[model samples]
Target chain A: MSLSVRKIVISGILGAISILLGVTRLGFIPVPTPAGHATIMHIPVILGGVLEGPVVGLITGAIFGLFSFLQPGAPFFADPLVSVLPRLFIGIVAYLIYVSTKNINNILALVLAGAFGSATNTALVLGMVTLRGYLPFEVSLSIGILHGVPELIVAAILTVILVKGIQRIRTSEDRPPVS
Target chain B: MELTRNITLGVYLPGETAIHRLDPRTKIIAATMLITLLLFIKSYEAYGFFLIFTAGIIVFAGIPLSYALCGLKPMLPVLLLMWIFQFFLYSTPDANILFSWWIFTATDAGLHMGNIITLRVLFLFTVTTILTLTTSIVNLTDGLESLLKPLRKIGLPSQELVMTMIIALRFVLILAEELDKIIKAQMARGVAFDRGSFIQKTRKLFPVFLPLFINAFKRAEELIVAMEARSYSGGKGRTKMKTLHMGRVDLGAGLIMLLFTILMIYIIISAAPQI
Candidate 1:
């Protein structure tokens, strides 16, 4: 199916936010982990999924993955397997979680969607890095726990806050004007 | 405060050098080929050749060597850390141990692993940087759209996808400025973003992000309406104001890339795998 202009613009803008975060280092949250910081860069991708749809999310994730792969933050990320392949799922997973859980509670759905999306990035990226023999399984596991927990928590909170805030703007704008 | 200054990924350096004059499609294809070749390069010989080739491209493009490498400055620490991690952690059976320290071992295999991966990453970044440097964003989008045109028959919205990428590139700088503003505004209100515990610092980001996301969505809504009002449809029948043409320079560049690829492949196949 063809992409609507809305999907195209939203995905592109969110992808811009993702890339901007990477460039400006605004996405890196200070953590005491050995790797220095945990990232909320994938938040834009999750937002894209929750706000627009899976296609938008997927495209935004692709953009993020491409940027990270091209100008890698870490050396192993030079490998497309570690950098690009696993990132494709962040938004799709977020979208799926949000849609499936939203009927239960909107706020809870946002938190779960954010948590799972961040989890998808950490787990899949580390899994690929380990599988590719860039880092040992034990090291990757520890790094995941150290970095992933913080990233997950922050992403969950940010998702709830940012989604609620954006939804407010979106719903109001989307409403038809009274005659 | 200067968030946009260090961003070089989408930045173009206009020039009249042969490398800059080559068609964007040719450059994109060549860069992709180089990246693919890099993946199978497990030996130092291949990387050596790869290094020479990339250096030659830099000179040909007339890009100052320092400028070409400046973007990599912030990444050096991370690169070194990754190398250290690989050196101390990556191993194979029957590998000769170079050193051992409490629960950490450095082996010959690990050394090779670290060196190769680090070199690969360096070359990868250089190649992509050069491509973006030599090509303008508009040319890149046009070339990519033209190249992916054939895929449209198979149901890929290639043009729209490229359009999205263009938007992504265009908005990066815009959003970065907005982010800078938000951070400053928060700091002005005594956010003290620089001094805080991990949780406390993270707590500060919420105020910053809420405004950023809301502002971005507002811009998106405005952009959507503007495009729709202009009778914007998908790329079904859209025509370009300027068409692309591949001239003699592209042929020359193509031949050079072909020769380099063949030589690199030979070196790759003949050299023993490093690890």
Candidate 2:
């Protein structure tokens, strides 16, 4: 339907933002961690899921995953399972968390959704990396803690602020023009 | 950071070589075959052959060696780290120990593994860069759409998927430009992005991303309204203005690929693996 086209357009833009973040290295913020940088790339997928539905989130996540696979930093992400599959779930999980918690409290729902979405990416990617024997389980876990905690914090704060701003815009648009 | 200047992905360099003229599907399939071979290649001899073959392709495609490799500069640090990791961590029981340092040992096997993996990554990147450099975005979309049409039988929305991919590629540059502007505007406001401690620098980035993302979403909304105004719908019953056709050039490329694949298989079976 017409709604689907709109979804596609939004998803495409978000997907572009994800890829742009990777290409330009703008997604990487210099955090004093083992990895030296924390990525905001996954934020787009989270935003897509919150603003639209799971389908848009899934599409945007796939694009993000594909870019990661193409330009893998670690050998583990060269595998599609590590790179693509985990990303596909980011949007779906975020959407589910957001929907389940929306009635309880809006800001809390957005924060939890963002944190969980980021946590899902960290857990799944590192879990698969260890399972594949790319790095030792202990090493993977430590790296995840060092990198994931900061990423989750950033994702949660940004997602809450972004969702609130977007909602305000939508509600205002819904209102009639002031004379 | 002049990030846009360094990006080579999705930046099509127009050329008129045979590799450029071949159908995009053929190039895609060939790139896939080469990447698969890269995953299994274990011997230095095979890698030497791969280097020659890739270099030949770059020459045939008329891409300058320097231009083809400019993308690798930013990647050097990651590649070096990977090499170092493989040097200390990857080892076989029979490996000759080169050195030992506090719970870490470098071995001959680890050295070879590191070298081979780094080479694999380098060639893999070069191959993909060549593909994008020669192939225009429109041709890539059309070729991908046509190639993926068979999946439509399983109710897969391939057209919409390709459309999304194309748009994402196009926006890589656009978004980077927008990001550059945001960084400059922030700089004009006396934000010192480069002078802070690591954590402080990271925290400072929050202000930049907030506006960038908000504007991105606003642009997305405006895009949606614009598309809706144009009566845009999903890829239902949509027809292509220019349909794809396989020519004699594609046949030649296919034959060459088949021969190369067989030769690679032979080398893989015959050569001794480095590990």
Candidate 3:
């Protein structure tokens, strides 16, 4: 399968945004939890899925996952099982959710996509951490709830806002005469 | 305000040392092997050896020790927190309790796990930092593309994927500059990014992200147009301007990596599990 130029560039830029959020600590919102932050890094992956397609989302997630693995923010993320493997699903899941639910309502679809996408990251990464014996199930579950809820809320809101904003640009550019 | 100052990943420090001169493919492979080795290392002896090996590479590559470690500064808090988490939360049967506080207990098993996992993270960061520091982005792209070309047989779109990574690496600094400007602009408009309640702080980020995502998509559109105008197609019948070659330095590096790997495996096998 060949990647269109649009897919490649969008994925790349989105991945760059993910990396930037990570390195600058902007993606991590301060929270009153033991982990101290909830991440919006996967938003770019979700956006990639919602705006482009699953392939772009998958590629962006891979880059985000690679960055986390190489420059891990958390100790367990040093394990690829806990970091890279789970990230690949964020975008794909978001895409599936958005596509299936959009006919019912666009905004609701975007929110669900964002919420489920963030959930995928939290559940899978924590599950892997627990499975690999890094964190106990009790701790993982607590962190999952504390960190995951905030992440889901932020992701859901951001997904609707960013997707709408980006989609407006694409639609305008695609039909320049109307704009 | 200076968001770009602390970033060391994806930033290449030009050098003429032997380690810098080695092929990117070799460096990538060596880093991957080291990462794999780190996963199996549960004992202190193995980590000691691993630390020495990585330090030697840093010195040989002419990277100042401080500079090599400076990227780790921001992560120190998280590392300490993680260590604390493991020390208190992780426990095994037959493990002696080191200490106990109200509703909290630390055990020898927890201590060992914390130390080892923290060490693993430290080494993992160091190894990857060294690889990116020594290798230029262009060389990295070439090496990765060449290395992944074999997987094209499985219809994985290796070229396109590498192209995506290349773009990601190149755009990180660019997008960072954009993010920096966006934050500054928001701050100018009385968006106190670092203040307010939890939800309030999250609300402040909305203005920052809308413009950032919009701007990034705009750039993507321009890039797509430019590439299409230049007749860019995914990896089909593409020719390289310069082909990669594995020289004598690569062979010598390979030998060193082999010896280190064998030694590490031996250490891992013989050392008793710390827990």
Candidate 4:
């Protein structure tokens, strides 16, 4: 009962930060493609999911998606469903990957989770925006493909760092438990 | 840590206002309905009424005007970019140019487009923010799950999704608090976080995040064990401790939303099309 109360408090704080970072722009680098903008700020989200589990991760992704949908510049021009549903998918997919994996390195699980979560976010949001017919299909695909490469790479690296680092902490706490 | 400071959604500010006391499901649907109406708001007059109506809600909810608008700080840049894009790309063939520079030209139509679009995004954020600010996280989850339950027939797994959402919403503040602590702990050392080049500052973030990541994973593993101990399973057979109800508040809120949507639709037809 006490832990559940503590978890709720903790969860609220993480959700708030995710929304804040997800909304603020750190200056986007306009790419050659219509929606090309490069920013590496999604690191918190990747960490948020892997650390808090898929539930936290999904919420982070959903919040990011919601923020994007609220943007007037959104290619699909910002529908609420477009903003939210993809994020929801990102969260579920990442967690699903983590839960389904065999007992191996935690780093590997985190990597897959981050990669899948982020990729789902990018794919679903971009697909919905494209459906709005603001830009041509080929153009949107090119943009998605181009930006996806870096997003995936960063997600993979972040997963390893966060997952391994978190595992180390758990083991350290356990070390003193039996003593 | 600092990032979560701007978050106001699903916060449940603990108030005595009428909106605050409304059922969580009612507020959720009211917010959704109002936002949908907002999306179709095309006229200055309609938006004027909306602005007034939104302001009324803010006051009624006991939220300070400044407190509400302050949340837009982080979103300002994106709004500006949207406005800029509208300025350059939205001109019609016969639209009069308001300003002209190198290649980018700002037209009257484009200017209107910018205003309407920006106004829409701003209001959308505000409405949702207010909703979360009043409703508790658990109630919000229950409401969302109840609302989404119909999607189960379509293979939506709405219950599980809502559970994930509830946990996510809860974490927003926790991570922020944790982040602040970790950052301060680092600053206690010789780490000069604020006194370095942009790249250097960013690079120094590695140590801060290193600890945060480790703590987060530990929490997740702990959560997993705790769940197993409780014999927890997925959304299949799970039952709710609290059931949803549609009180008078929902009916009142629903009527208000219907009236607002009707008025907005009428104005949308009468107003000049910005697009």
Candidate 5:
């Protein structure tokens, strides 16, 4: 597709939002204190996937990962690969999930798809991270489960809303207007 | 927990020192050797020698002592928990009970186990951090890609893996910046994120992550089309502008490692085992 003002605007908006949610240290729910909460911080990223598909999703993942790396507190040995694989997986999984389902069952299916995408993301990341010997086997395994459940729940709810919202807009655009 | 921030474990601090300029391949290989040595080190004296050796590298790499130690912030709680668990759970036949509390007993063996294990982790992170801090990401990627290039013959897709790695590395910074912006946007909307109970604060997170994940997918799709438009293909034919080679500095580093290894081995053989 040719370059458009909409693409630029959406990217700038999403980038701005992503940078905001990622750096604030705002969501420090006691349960997962250090890593902070999952929240809707990933929305710009998911939207990136939905709009541009998986490749853009992967690029967005890279952007998100880089954002984490450059934080003042960024760890030196921080592996960008940990961030890339998971987000890339999310993009691919989300794209596939969106395309595969014929009937848009409102928001439920979309939410499930988002959850599965998030789960795919968590598994790949934690898997590589554990391999690198940074995290102990047990903690890494525990994280996979703990982080996975919340991401699923959060992703599911928001994805459903987003999918439906987008669908509505698309339908409105497809409508034939009368004079 | 993948504590994405805790990844500095293997960073090499770049410096003007001799070790910093060694071929990435040599450093990578040497680091592997050092890590392997660490696993075999079972005695306090052995670790002491390892400590001195690593300290030398830290000094050479120009990493501040406190700064190097700070990478453990995220892992501190888990390490402490690990120590606590081992203290209460691990026991041996000759273990002496040092303290007793409500259904919990601390033993000499357990204490030794915790101390030694914790030290191991500390040194482990330290060693790796020094490596990464010293080596630039581009160099690291080039080094790693070249090292893995041989595996390409066996169908490894080395270039793609390296490309993937570099992108991931870039993300650690990009996403943080993104998160920062998103938080501000929500804050502008009067979301008092910091003013709630644990559960309430968590609930507030819905707005934050909803946007983050959605944007992430959007970026990925755009990136893909951008790459395809450039006619990019998988790692079949890629060339390098700079090639890696081990020089005299690496030899010096090897000598240092050899001496350190021998001293460590002797300490392990003679010193009492923490176990």
Candidate 6:
């Protein structure tokens, strides 16, 4: 397969995963917070960055953002700035993090990339929401702490495990058997 | 775990009504116009007209009202919560107090805000749902691609983007089925997914998602290879198997939409804005 087609297909798959996560409500883990659910929707965007490149991540994140905007559960996410722009950064930042530390430790790199990606989503979304006067700064901060921290932790763990597993599969598939 | 069954977003129901026969672009443009009008709509009178218009379309499109509204069932809690928040939080200086409880106060203006916003959301959902219901996915794609073709001059890969969106939408159901299988497999292995506390349930999801994602990547890789083997290149120099045409029905639909737009504008101008 050509490289561009491969990237498009991979990104499309990741975007599909992101949308399916929201549509099926499987990605939303209910928590006792104002938002009621902590989402793993951004994880696929992070994974797209780690597996493919920043471009794929950006497209996947944009797709995820579009879905959230169309099917916004909260009023804040109905705005494209709050829903879409933050997500556009997820893949770029995650890819940068992964590349910087990839040689030293792949697993740690994945975890950090995942955490940073999730943190990017939380910080930018809430920051935009507060900036737009959707919610008070203190209220946004409290909700961020309540929902964002756990989401970051989950993203870190999942990103590490999934990247490791996929890497193993790719490497093994690339290897040839002894004669 | 039958989450896939509840999804009605992309599922197309075939019909032979004139509404269904209207050009996809016409439906798309009309829905957009209605949604734009919905945003500026304030008074109950406007919403009353909006409801009648939507109901007429629903009937004309041959879509069952219940089926059209089934998607809203899942969103009721969120909508209700939003209504409650607006009822207690939204008010103006001249508003009369309806009730007061501790730190929260409900006002007459708050009630109107709550009602208007909730109705707006409901109308928005209905409009989109109607568009999707009346237009099939293939037509929807073609219409969107044609509409967005103007951006190609700016170096935007509009066709490729639309292709990606179509593929992603197709996979929503496929992945949901995959999730169901993974969840069932985990259950077979004695993971009581339904019996756990919220955190415990969420933690259990890691195992399911890990496998699902791994398999998804594998599927994507295979799909890429399959497309490459078929010599499939995106968007560039692609010819349509069926080109879209605007028939007489589209012109009629366009005229009706224009009339609705004018009426909505009149109401928006004359009606008092809700505080």
Candidate of highest DockQ: 3
- Measured by lDDT, the strongest candidate is 3
Residue B10 deviation, candidate 1, in Å?
0.7
Whole-model lDDT, candidate 2?
0.84
lDDT of 6 by residue, A16-101 (tens): 99988887777887877755778899999999999899989999999999877766666556566788889999999999999999
Model 3 lDDT, residue A144, Cα: 96
Model number with the top TM-score: 3
Q: Which residue pairs of candidate 2 clash?
A: none
For model 3, residues B198-238, the per-residue Cα lDDT tens digits are 99999998999999999988898899889999998777899
Q: What TM-score fits each model? A: 0.96, 0.94, 0.97, 0.75, 0.65, 0.92
Model 4 quality (TM-score): 0.75
What is the C-alpha lDDT profile of model 1 across B22-95, one tens digit per residue? 88899999999999998889987778788888999999899988888887876787788888888999999989
Q: Give a tens-digit lDDT track for model 2, residues B75-121.
A: 67767876787788777789999999998889998888788768877
Question: Candidate 5 deviates by what RMSD?
Answer: 8.0
Query: Alpha carbon lDDT of residue B47, candidate 2?
Result: 89
Enumerate the candidates' DockQ scores in order: 0.80, 0.53, 0.84, 0.24, 0.10, 0.49
Worst 10-residue lDDT window for candidate 5 chain A reads A69-78
Each candidate: chain B TM-score:
0.94, 0.93, 0.96, 0.88, 0.84, 0.92
Q: Mind giving the per-residue lDDT tens digits that candidate 3 earns over A1-179?
A: 88888899999999999998998888989999987789999999999998888998899999999999988998889888888999999999999999999999999999999999999999999999999998889999999999999999999999999998987887777785844
Least accurate 10 contiguous residues by lDDT in model 4 chain B: B1-10
Off by over 4 Å in 4: A1-17, A23-38, A41-60, A70-77, A80-157, A167-179, B1-5, B89-94, B192-198, B233-244, B272-274
Docking quality level of the chain pair in candidate 1: high
